[model samples]
Target: MNCADMLNNLDSSIDTLHTRTKLSEVILKKGISKKDELIEYLRAELSEAFDCRVGFWLQGSRKSHTLIKPVDKNSSYDIDVGVYLFFDAEDEGLSASEIKSTLKYALASYCEINDEPTLQDSKNACEGLKYSAFLTIDTPIYYIAHDNATPMLATDSGWVDSDPKAIQKWLTDAQDTDDKRALMKRIVRYLKAWINVKWNGTEHKKIPSLAINILVARHLKQFEREDDSFIHSTLSICEELEGFFKVENPLNGQDILTLTYEAEVFAHEKLTELKAACLEANDASELQKCLIFSRLFEHYFPQIELSAFNRISGLPVTVTVPELTINHYDKDDKHIRTLNINEVTVKKGESLTFSITNKAHFNQYCSAHWTVRNIGSQANDANDIGHKVVSSITESHQRGAAYTGSHTIECMIFNGATVVGANCIKVTVKPAFPVLRRKKIFKGFRR
Candidate 1:
């Protein structure tokens, strides 16, 4: 059916939303009343949060809260809601985290009966609130996953959301391409943060954690861009998750999903096999490791790697400096140029040098450069400049032949990168040796 048709169906659902039946302790009438009132209060408060800007309220709990079992007069109950903020630039363009911190104070200020606000203002981000088209959040206390959220209180539409398969099909379907994709993004975020209160034996009663939520949002966002194969999209999600969670797998680049009819089906069995295979696949490439771990991440996580709550880390600019040098210490291999110095051991400010020749490995008459970086340094941040070109001598083709230091020198040679086996050649400036000065004498001076 068309969106209009679907929307018409929703219209009927809306009518019956207010008309209620008693579900255990919750009177549907009273619940709806309470919900409406709460929404109004929220609308007003969120306006001031962004300095009088409008905020939106998307009701995931569009139905009345009905207890699964009967509730007594004084029993605790669960209530979950989703609220999106429409900022008014009050944050000076600060991050969503900063805005969240600000909004907390705003909510407290408004809800305050006294010096303190009643309940802590909750700010959850499903994705890109910092640079978002609009701020968004998806919250549910009722269900573990968005695909299985408690259906809205509607008459014809019933309550639960449509099938995941249906949603997937609709996105790829030529008819509802746009709408379906829009929804897929929403689904990713929701699944990422879904309580999954009963997942693989997790018992988090509160909302979903930050990392999982980000994971879901990211993967779903990826799935939205897919038009080729569902399995590919799913597998890509796994790959991303492996990187995201820093998980190691054996199937990094392998398309294990193609081995099965579909991913969702073999997710469980494939997980066991892949895990075992990863264990046995000793000395596998990082790609192979990523392959195995991606699948595991795919099965467990529904979100992406980055979000407002848990921004994904940027890629590490890795540069390796091979320990390549001429063995000046070895009598047989010693050369006139590029003499290997002592092993490098000093702080950054302390300088070190190596003897080099006119035909040094790092020297270039034309196009060669050296790189230096602090790789694998625990104290260095990822943003630290890990690669640098120390010196490049274009004058190597001249008559100058380097007898002491080399003609070509590369600074990046200091980057601490080795190819598996410790192929390192350490270099440090040697202590200067004193040479005795002899007085000028003629050839017959011995007489």
Candidate 2:
């Protein structure tokens, strides 16, 4: 591929990597539902405890949909939820510690009632609820001024001016008139993913997401090519920061980076690394560019197949196995020919066998690994779909006798971690027949 075509393909791959799939969307929806439930519980409890109304709102990257999934599966993703107390601090004689303590008490009660683990008080700003090893919800207590609706976060020092709503609005407004806003957001996600990869399993101080957002929004410029735009915008931000590193809160123009000197240094170092990588990628040959990108992005960037790259570079491709086919079998050991439409139907509790065969030239070797996944259903229990590996074929059975639903079954053939070929078949499962008691009649004595 030419430079433009290669860069275009890389951009497309980045977009695919960043786009949230339907399953992921469903998972996030479930997470938000739980967050909403907890928020409601806390609101009621705090209202009862303080004898006043309490309001809540969402903030941060989760609210903006710019959150990047962590490279490591065990890494934590946070959703920020703000609880606003609708009473004057002066009237209640409430201090920041008091507010934090009250909110912690309410959350503790909530955890007890729901049979969940107790929330941890960070004591810096927010209380954390660990939903899973990979997910957390950070609830920050805020007090609303009686005279106005100004929001203030309860910190150890005192009430600090915090306007998450205004900041979120500013971010939204920054992209309002820009035609390349979508691409801008995608680039931001890419940058965040890069950060995650760069800082994985390290104790190094990382750049705050808000600070990154602020820098990108302030310095990002549009270009005809996405690669050029990403490179130029990133370099611009880095170079600008060399003089002085400061990111202001969009709402009040207060410097948010003043207290984060270590993070600023970290950002500079990472950006410098990125600059070097971009330079290398720009100077490398077409086939080498792919390798450069793969190194820069690690596993997140899809690697170009060696065969394809060899072909492009005028080298003889050695792979003889060029075609893969999937065959399905029924319960009676009968081969069921898959139609061109690629759809399958089975009764509940029936087992289906799938085999992948490779068409190869003489004296060529081929190997394959199989993976099956349910695409649309919420109940993704492993026990519901049991699979056993027998030789090269995989036999998967739907064990749920009463289950009736349509779910997409995706069968993939992998050459190591890279997907070589794949097939998706929509499986419609019919409900099992209800058992009925037969009326018994004696042969000689009729009823």
TM per prediction: 0.25, 0.65
- Mind giving the per-residue lDDT tens digits that candidate 1 earns over 1-447? 011121112343321101111122223334444445555665676565454444333332222122211111122222334444433232245444454445455444544533321443242322111101111222221111233333221112122221222322332442245654444443333232122211223232232222232233234433322211222334444566444323211222222122222433333343334334435323333333322222222212111111121111221233223233442322232233443442432222223333234334332332322322122112111112112122333222111111221112222222122111112222332223437688986677454
Candidate 2 TM-score to native: 0.65
Best by TM-score: 2
Q: Estimate the overall C-alpha local distance difference test score of candidate 2.
A: 0.60
Clashing pairs for model 2 are none
Cand. 1 TM to true fold: 0.25
The whole-model C-alpha lDDT of candidate 1 against the native structure comes to 0.29
Candidate 1: list runs displaced more than 4 Å: 1-35, 46-51, 59-102, 106-447
Q: Candidate 2's residue-wise lDDT over 1-447, tens digit each?
A: 343343334453232334421125545666678788898888778898888888888888887667655554455567889888888875678899888888887777777877654587575878768765446788898888775677888987788889888887777777656556665676677677678777766577666778777777877778776666777777778787777777778777777665455656676787788887777665667665654554455434432334354343322344233233334455454666643344566666555544444423322222332323232243221112212111222323232222456644334333443333334445666644547789997679556
